[model samples]
Target: MTAKFHAFLQNGTWELVPYDASMNVVGSKWVFKIKRHLDGSIDRYKARLVSQGFTQVPGVDFTKTFSPVVKPATVCTILALVVSCGWDIWQLDVHNTFLNGFIAETIFVHQPKGFEDNNYLHHCKPSLFIYSREKITIYVHVYVDDILITGSSSAHVSHLISNLSQTFDLKDLGPLHYFLGIEFHRDAFELILSQRKYILDHLLKINLAAAKPVSSSMATSFQLSRFTREPLSDSTQYRSIVGALQYVTLARPDVAFAVNKVCQFLQSPTDEHWGAVKRNLRYLKGTIDSGLIFSAHSSDTLIAYFDADWASFPNDRRSTGGYGIFLGSHLTLWRAKKQPTIAWSSIEDEFRALANTTTELL
Candidate 1:
């Protein structure tokens, strides 16, 4: 993986230069994994070179880092339009896509292991830019190395892919089946999105395969308090559970509030919190097949809903604000967070939540 990234850098894909005095360089690390076949056979050993984006300081390293993404509703709307118009929808992937993005901040990456250029000995520079070539629409969705590219015409898609292939070795996966862990299936009538495989894998990983599933994500009367019976000995285990549940909520919004509530206790979890976390896993066992599905729909309108619970947190008297945004029938974004300030009334709390949601929407 390091070698591949080094080659990408060498070919004017992206570059490593001196870190800017004003910008903080986010860390990078190599992720190693093994690929497997559908039948559980080993495919090959793989490695991912990723940026430790968590360290990025919001305004210094990146201003306006939030990139607008196609909502699930938008995706569904497009699918529905395709179905109604009888237009062919094809998926194209651009391999090593982040390499194409020009970094505005001066940044440097340690020469990849085993493939370092000894001659350079010091610094390297990037050569690619948005205007380097014009055959392709540069709009690309990047989540690490995996990318999904779409264009208005097949010819445009083909031209873009051809141009990208010239820069780096490109793999044509043909049509969008799976990207970003979401499974997609399209036919003449409709398109379906689900995370069945991911959910099953998650359940098994958390040892909840045989656990009895719950009907809903949380109990109706369930409430969490920072004060609990006994402190957990290992906070790491609690955090691991929180991390797993966070991923599961990607397809399961029913558990978003519960999961976000429990995540706050990662720093000092208790037995009560642990029990609730386990219950969430049990809930997952039953809803392993549940996922956001975008069908053929007519709505292209975007709407948002916001709410807040005043003084919900007993420890700090902080309110919890929740919001969900929808493009049409599909839920695109949802957040549950503890407000920073204490609210005197429910109305004030709701106002704050609305402000936050509006900021996010804009």
Candidate 2:
């Protein structure tokens, strides 16, 4: 508590104020955490003081309306120079930092109960400006999905169909023709999987599933942001399409990264994010024939490659790491994940990636 309090004081996170009867006051509480070593021994105890910020009023307390210091032109100019001149790119991650701006409002957090400090007077102003880094608070949007059933047995399939027909309002679409947008091709040799019909229907649903297919998964210089000024009104449609694209990744690993990036803004999708999703879908339109192939070949050898992008995230500047593992010359496992801790250097980030990949190999 003392360490955190002193750190807060040094950071100037908030100013002490007197108890005010007229203005609304916010409450705060202490949070506790424990850090442990690799051997599971206790390393240290951590405490944080968090404000109950739900009490803050919109107009009276703070205003988020502000202009960006770095204009769109500046970002484009820098990127254009890099593309043309082939410049080296560098990134850095610095935590506990904010773009400190002056604010005219004078709001305050109330003093803790029973702690009478002279500095915490009745009416005091605390927060000076909004921090550039804010904690992620996710509000997941829910959508209902239908279950698709499949198995290999004429007798068993018939028995299960009789049971389901007895239990609920069942429509017997014989031979597993098409269920939940997935089309199946089965014969004596093997059963093939494809979403050609589903993709086409959804494309026509959005009036672009059949549009000219693009060669790229996503266009170069794709601009996406969480704080985009213009938000799409059909955010629900965006969410649904993104969800479908996620299912498509089950069969198509090529578009996984692009789809994963777009899925981040399901709750509040911007027009830019929606456009990126459409680009990915258009890519899928070209590669609808792409599907996983079943093979009997097996090998005992395991091969893996790991890499990391230092300070990849624009919002928090956190590094991202990923690895791909191949067993017997076939891809068995692969993942792309963001690093938990910020890396100070490229070497540090790559070392962390190696460590994580080694763990996965084990």
Report the number of clashing residue pairs per model.
0, 7
In model 1, state the lDDT of residue 95. 40
Which ten-residue region of model 2 has the weakest summed lDDT? Answer: 136-145
Q: Give the TM-score of candidate 2.
A: 0.47
Candidate with best lDDT? 1
What lDDT would each prediction earn against the true structure?
0.67, 0.58
Off by over 4 Å in 1: 1-6, 9-30, 36-43, 49-110, 116-139
lDDT of 2 by residue, 1-362 (tens): 66555545566767765564677777767777774432346756756566677788777777665642332222222322222332322211111222345779765666543443665456443111112224311111111111222223334435544664453334334443343344545444333446776676678878895588889887555545688767888798998888888777645657766776787788888878888888888888998887643223434567889888788667667777888765544444556677888889999999999999888778
What are the clashing pairs of model 1? none
- Name the regions of candidate 2 deviating beyond 4 angstroms: 1-193, 220-223, 358-362
